[model samples]
Target: MSQGGTSIPDEEWERFLREAEAGSAGAPQEPSARARMVTRRLREQPGPPEGWRTYRPARRRRGKGWYVLGLAAAVALLVVALVPGLLVGWFGGGDGADAPRAAGETQRPDGPPAQEAAGRLPTPDRPFSGSPAAGWADGTAGIHLPAARATGWMSRSEVEQALDRTRDFLAASSLDRAVLRGERPSGAMALIDPHQSDVHEFIEKAFRAPDRENDPLLLFSRFRPSDVRPAGDVVRTRGRISFREGERDAVEVSTDVTYVYPVVRAEAGSEEVVRTVVRREVVLSWNDPAKDRVEPGTFSLVSYKVDATNGGCDNTYTGYFTPVFGAERAATGAGDGAVVDPYDRSTPIGERMREAGDAGGGTATRS
Candidate 1:
């Protein structure tokens, strides 16, 4: 049978020849070896005249030297085009099948990076629970007592010592010349909880800002022992301590502190001292089986917050003072220039607080 422009089957051609021979002889003829040989020779002959041809199979044209050379060149070009990409993928450059990645683009194990997948703060292992006993309030300037009795995790004396140590450390660090010069205070990490990345970032930024002099924390260095009325009253500090139970054998001790300091400034070319009152609420977490253990009386500072600020100082300036401790404001200009808010809420401390309230009372954290 014909297929497209090709010839009929070999079986059909053989049958036709047998039928013609039988009809001519008037009987089935067993063809002689000579006749069969002649028939095979005719089938083998190339390009017979169209009218005379009975059976002819299509032939494949043999390529010339140039044709073979052209084919070889095309194959070489194809291999050259693919080898680089194949090598790149095999050597871990990237998925070579896809477009090459741009510089600085992070290669992910699968899909997009974690931050891009969902624009939200990371969920804490154990989020803060419960609220501060007293909603944000002013802590008086005196020896305020603890609101709740100490639990087994932390004793009354241990809590008292922790508070005292924290207060003293803050005071000492504020006046430390090394810290003013952008050097981290010694033993500073001991007071901070290693697991609290936010607190650590806040501390680093407060001390390590490129412009050391303009750093907000440097404002504390301006205070001299003689600035306050009483020699030892340079720091008018007061705090109230409280405690609550937390997950994983931990105790949350909240210390509401108020620090009133004198910020001496030159206004209208005249010397004037501004009494900046900074109120802050600090939460210290004490865990029995902490990853980083301290001396018997010490506790880790998990978190802290600036509850409120008043006494004519801008909230931005006062806020930083409590949490870490600005902005550049002209010494003589009143309300003419703005103070730069040094506290970067995008930092780790701000990020952590966004996920959970400072006092642990809010159900939803700010992402």
Candidate 2:
């Protein structure tokens, strides 16, 4: 019905029905009631003015919608890729969760102090335990062998300084002038406390040879510092020197050390001929620091020979030196004497020619 409604005749309605049927029969089936209703409403709307109502085709849009969709997809993919990495960082990785505790800690379920754990070493930053009185006794027995002769061991600092001096002495026949005065005499005196006093003294005195003695050329000079360091109190210092004799080289060496407290002293002498080493003797004693004397005890020295040229040998000597004997020997300058510089002319007529001609054994003569 038009906006200006007017009743239509029955004949006009019949004619309209006939035309709709003809249109349906000529093409597809007729529209349903609802579709027809929608079509009539659209047709009834007022048309554009004048001839402009004729016709106009629709145009497709080319806006940013497609680009926006592509951006959304890329952002989704990036999120998927980074999520796992972010989670791992927030929580610890596999390694952190499974790692074992560091060595030095107490392994018991009720963990004790970290320093006491098995196989763990206290860091350098930590302080050493209580007094060093018996500290050296437990950890470094090999350093002071033969309990009877074990006394004064060297302090770490003392050993280090002595080694430094040795290097300087070797370079120039003098101690580092900046550190000490005068020429570095060819003798080494690394003295520790009473604990190992006898050992130190014995070593200092034992490593000497008269110029007329069998072997003249003292070839090698070296110090081997071991890791089995004294905890405290007792200390150790080792020096090795080689003397050339015969076709083979006879090495005279000693590790002079002392054990403090119940003070013990030792001098371990070793001789190497060819490729074999013979532990010549080990001197030991109990020391009385107050009196600056070795107590009333017996010290001993053993001699052994090894023939490495044919493989090895087993010839060992066993003996002991009593306190009385040691005292007598010391008096004669055989047990504890002023460090002798073989190179020193004052060493006596017999020993003068045995002196090292120069700091470096680079030059040699039969004096």
Candidate 3:
């Protein structure tokens, strides 16, 4: 909310509005001097995370000082806008009463204070600042690997190699821009052991012709490019990865990485950034050719589970991620365990595999 450590008062926000309105006639939409100062301060700060470095949402562009005003709105914990309505379609109205709840946010009242107040629009420079993902790592950085140790079946060096490959597979499946924009997840699928043709071909066929039962989302996240685009290039992430010895001289690695994607409707002049979260859980079996008759240096996909929060329930038929926009959906009865908080990183996806991360707890409050 504070831009480069400076706080913005509510009344001062109103003053910007008045000044902008008065200057509207025969005036330019250029940023004010104060906004320019904020821009300089931001440039002095660190750059955004590096994961998929070349992804730009086809036609989106930014104006000067929007990041300053956007961060100001966020830090204030009030609705966004320095010059209210001057930057149209960016955030909820100034007053707390005008705050709009995001379409499929699932945090309970007991959750974080920022989430308690709804409609916190992200700035291009700091997309995760107003959400639970604020504290999460950007892109592949969140997928941390454990120290390699001998685990009966695999040697220490081999275990390390396996871990490295697993991380690559994860990066390809979740953070790859090509995979996200509805392309075949070849980068990820290629890691699958070719001998395990059943699982490999199943994924290939699913992508070729997808449906409810054969969803590629089972292994990767894909959204229709025509419907929505990532708000900023960054994708916030947090979760755990674990490994254990498996049957048939294989090592089983289980990973639970939750991805928070800030997105907006794919239309010109649209700027309200909403988030869609997807939690992907996968079990990878790294088979040893010496004993299992498997291909060398590859893993077989054992199983996978994917759950999406804020991805529209109605959009499931298309087998693409189409998150709800504008308004909330009516409550529903069908769900797993509890309402799965896509933001809750504390929940474990698999049985205790040596305490991968966060303390265990209840999942999100489902509708």
Candidate 4:
């Protein structure tokens, strides 16, 4: 097959080993079955839709200097053939092969290049210098190369302000929004905003059973920011979420956020040193006390508290919610037996929730 005046095989699998080895460093592990099929289809054709591109393996080429050397070698071979005395002298250990002797003289016991042709040395650790997936056109559009690691020190106030801006943004905005926009403000306003009920609905839908319909109404009775403290070059805020019991098929409404900002050193001729904010986020096990109830009628507002912690200090917050659910597992026993006890689940939930914010928590679910 002719592609850009170069011959390409009709079947990729036929030369898969060679191509894969050549591209081992620059591409992701081989795609899975569905992805492979999609790639194969696109490879057989040409352009794809706007958002997608046809799979094209990256090609590596020798440098122009090496090409020139190759041409020179070919010309030298021609000259040597015309002059038989040179080849005979080279085999007979004459000065004509002095360059090869000098090259062999540089060989070492454990050196990588010594094992191969000196001019075609293998890579040390990885093969390619850059990966197509990690290039500018990839998702990291505005990311500048990380500046040199900071020396000197950052002030406590500077760290606080950076932490505050990131915290406020995460608390107020959705993570999807924050990641897309590449910024978040420092405050719990986002977490406390009345407009965030859709977030709970989205969480519920994520866990609902195929046979069961979910109409989750999350009422955040209390949302508060307890404290903020400087830790290294970042500031951590501890908070809580509490609500009344309400109708939820399988709701997972937990929130944890971390923000990282660059520590700028005082410079002579720099306007603003932009610090990249890296957020460490967490989503605790959902607290569902008002689950499948016996009565289809209204239920009292049960409290659900998220004891979120940072480091060793625990910050607790409670809220009230009244959920309504259709009659399905209305039987007095729905959950996995005594594990359904309110106090039992509540105690462990609080303790583990605190641990979740500190050390990542264990997995538990109410089905």
| Candidate 4 residue lDDT tens string, 158-225 | 22232222222233332222211222111222222222233233323422421111211111111111
On residues 241-360, what C-alpha lDDT tens digit does candidate 1 reach at each position? 556775454666555444433333322332233333333445555656443343343355543333222122221222123111122223212222111111111222222233333222
Give the TM-score comparing model 4 with the true structure, all chains together: 0.17
- Clash pairs, candidate 1, are 131-361, 198-348, 198-349, 320-325, 327-340, 354-366
Q: Residues 171-283, candidate 2, lDDT per residue (tens digit)?
A: 22111111112211233221112233332333333334212111111111111112011112211111121111111111111222111111112233311111101111111
Candidates 3 and 4: which is better by lDDT?
A: 3
Candidate with more favorable, higher TM-score: 1 or 4: 1
Model 2: lDDT to the true structure: 0.18
- Model 3 poorest 10 in a row by lDDT: 66-75
Best by lDDT: 3
TM-score of each: 0.37, 0.16, 0.61, 0.17
Q: For this target, which candidate reaches the highest TM-score against the unseen true structure?
A: 3
Rank the models by TM-score, top first: 3, 1, 4, 2
Which residue pairs collide, candidate 3? 1-74, 1-75, 339-366
Between candidates 1 and 3, the one scoring higher on lDDT is: 3
Each model's number of backbone clashes? 6, 30, 3, 26
Error of 1 at 310 (Å): 8.0
The local distance difference test score of each candidate is 0.30, 0.18, 0.51, 0.19
Candidate 3: segments with Cα more than 4 A from true spot: 1-119, 123-125, 328-340, 349-367
